[model samples]
Target: MSMTANTAMAASTPRRGSSIAWSDVLLNIYILIFFLYLFVPLLIMIGAAFNVNSTPSITDWQGFTLDWFTGEVDEETGRVIAKGLPQEDRFLQGLWHSVIIALGVVAIAIPLGLSGALVLTRLQSGSTTFLYTLLISPILTPGIVLGVTTMIFWRDIFSVEAGLFTTMIAHSTFIASYCMLMFMARLQRQDRGLEEAALDLGASNVMVFRRITLPFLRPTILTAAVIGFLQSMENYNTTFFAIGGSWTLVTEIGSRMRFGLTPVINAIGVIFIVITVVAAVAWVFFRKREKG
Candidate 1:
């Protein structure tokens, strides 16, 4: 009887192993599919950047050239030999505008968000919920609505026409809410006893906030600023309506798509990809060092 039971148990162990192996194979297939879905387009885009084709495409293999990035011009006639990023003055200007707006958004959003978060976290009252909802309503509002309203309000009230200034304001209207949420999350986990003790020890409210609270919230502030900047850079609908004739890098890209598609766009994408990858790698290394 003991030998029969041992043989049965051994057979069941092999059956379980086979099942586990099959599941592993399925999981691997799913992972492969997901990665392909993400990277195949990126690979195609990168390939097209190096292609000599006037139009950006990987289907028709053009001869490889770096003209899209470095550009080409006939020195004798001063004619465009190969249109490149340097020749795209509007695109370059738009990129500069995007950086400026992003910086402005970060500047405006961080302070407003920090104020809202501080109030919501520290002020214990029934009205806190109402105030929180009011502050965050801008985020829930449609981008179109925000854009139109911001444009009209500034133009009517402040005599400010739609431009980078209005665009920054529109972006901040929603981005501040995002920053506030990040700040609030950080504040919720804070040890309030330290603040209380500091106050009891004759520290002024401002001193306690500067030394204790600000130090604790520093990470969230940096994170919120980054998020706000990225949000401002990528925003299209709100920016489009609020900016009027002004444009950002994203808007310029969209405009180019309407008239003609070029490898320069692909070059821009590749540059962005490289920057993002480098930043991510740097962050990983920094985090590892921090942990160590």
Candidate 2:
């Protein structure tokens, strides 16, 4: 009986191993498929940027060239044969506009968000729930409605035309909620004892906040600023209606898509990808170095 049981157990071991191996193989295939789905289009876009084709295409590769970055040069006359990213004045302007709007959104959103977070977190009131709901309502509101309402509000109330300012305002409306959430999360983790101790030691409320509260919230503020900037930069629907005659880099890209796509757009994507990768790498290294 012992001999028979030993043989049976040994036989079952191989079957278990085989099942485990098959599951691992299936998992690996799934991961491969997922990664391929995620990155294949990005790889195609990057490839298209180098292709000499006028239109953005990976399959119809004319030849590898840097004409997208630097305009096709007329060798004889030394003049531009075709417009490139550098020569695309409107796109460049739009990029500049995006940067400006992002900065403005960050500036506006961070302060408003901080204020809201402070009110909700510090004030012990029954109305806090209502106030919290009201403050966060903008985030739930549709971008189109926000854009249209913002445009109309400015035009009707202050006679301010929809432009970069309106676009910035529209972005800030919802972005502020994002910032507030970040601030609140940071605030929740804060040690209230320090503030209480400082106050007990005869420190003014302003001084306690400036020294303790502000220092604790610094990292969250930086994070919020970055998030706000990114949100403002990528915003489309709200910007489209609020911007009136103006345009940002994203909106300009959308407009171009309607007309026709170009390798310049791919070049832009590649540049952003490179920047994002570099930033991520730098952040990792910085964190490791700090830890070390």
Candidate 3:
């Protein structure tokens, strides 16, 4: 019996397959290299922020210093020689302009998006595709085209110069499309019967919208605001052309990259990285806690 069992076990374990595919191994290596390529620049940039050198480079590393972020500190006098003042910084000035534009985008985009979504969703005709395409054409158009067209149109027609206002408008033209798409998605999931019942019960159209539609869309409104704000903040080409001589933080960064590169720019990048990581972590934590 022992001999028979041993023979059976040996027979069951006798399988020998071909070697692992070189293609799969090469694909995994390629994936690793691809990730490294993407991350290496960010790592180098982050590393330079901690170096004391004025130039943004990791190869010529100086001792660690925080002067770029917190201004210069007097070593002997103990009083800060350069108190980390954002107000005195050109980058900070551009950041303030970015914030102003972002706020303006949220204000304009939310309303336009809401209106567009309303029209698209409520339309009873089958020929609504043309209108939808027309409305969404701005999103498909290149940002540079939008910026140049807006700048020229305003200059020729409205006598408005290309500046912060024009940048805000250029951003809104596409951003509103994003908001409208989000709103349309939410509206599709909505039970229209509730709105109709409210209207039938003598509620004014505005009242029904205010009480029913707005409440249901509150979550979407917040999401659209966040998306629109981020889009506005990160915009470059549109803002560059439509902003005339003015600058936002992103455009300022571009100009610095073109004219003079410095560790201060890396410092700015570090701040952005920290803020993004913190926000993502906090969002996850809050969501988990809420679910629990």
Candidate 4:
């Protein structure tokens, strides 16, 4: 009777492997589908960069060539030559403008964010919530509205026109909020004992800030810079409304998409992909080495 009961319990219980395997299989399938969805279009875009097609298409392979990326017209032979700078003058100039704007955004956002974070974290009053909300309101505002408002304010009040400066300002308005959040997160995790010990040692406020607080915030600063730069570089709506005559790389790409579509665009995409991949690889290696 005991043996029969044990056998009945075993028959009723499900196998562990069989139950877990279904969930594992489903998770793997989901991950595969997600990755494919993300990378399939990028692969197509990269392939088109290599193809010698006028239009950006991977369906019709037109052989491999890098002319679209760095092609130049030969003076004597009048043939397109490779190894020169990209021939899209507007795009190149726009890229430079984008770089300058990104730098400005980082410059403006990081300090402002640090200040706001410090204030919010240190405040012990109810007004802190109001101030925090005010500081972060720009982030919740629509990009279009931010851009338009910035353009109008600068033009009407400061006698400044819509250009790179206005665009940078507009970008910083929202980007500072992101930087503040990062700094706040980092600050929350920090050991207050270190700061208190420094204060007990009779260190001046500025010295304490420079030596302790700044050092503690170094990693956050780098992260904020990277995020701010990327945010400024890729911004469109705010930039479009704020920039009257100037353009950034992303804005130039939009204009090109509207007027002319070419493999050149694909080439740009390839460059961006290469940079992103290299950065990701480097970050992974850095983490592995740090762990080691």
- Deviating ranges (above 4 Å) for candidate 1: 1-20, 284-292
Residue 96 CA displacement from its true place in model 2, Å: 1.2
Candidate 4's error at 207, in angstroms?
A: 1.3
> Per-residue lDDT of 21-66 in model 4, one digit per residue for the tens?
7887999999999999999999999998888777878899889888
Tens digit of lDDT per residue, candidate 2, span 1-292?
9899999988987768677878989999999999999999999999999999888898997899887888776889988887788888888999999999999999999999999999899989899999999999999999999999999999999999999999999999999999999999999998999999999999998999899999999988998998799889989999999999999999998898889988899988899899889978988997899788
Clashes of 2: 0
The better-scoring model by lDDT among 2 and 4 is 2
lDDT of 4: 0.91
Error of 2 at 39 (Å): 0.6
Runs with alpha carbons beyond 4 Å of true place in candidate 3: 1-27, 73-88, 282-292
**lDDT, candidates in the order shown:** 0.93, 0.93, 0.89, 0.91
Highest lDDT against the true fold, candidate: 1
TM-score of model number 4: 0.87
- In candidate 2, what residue range of length 10 has the lowest lDDT sum? 12-21
Give the per-residue Cα lDDT of candidate 1 at 134. Answer: 97
Check candidate 1 and list the clashing pairs: none
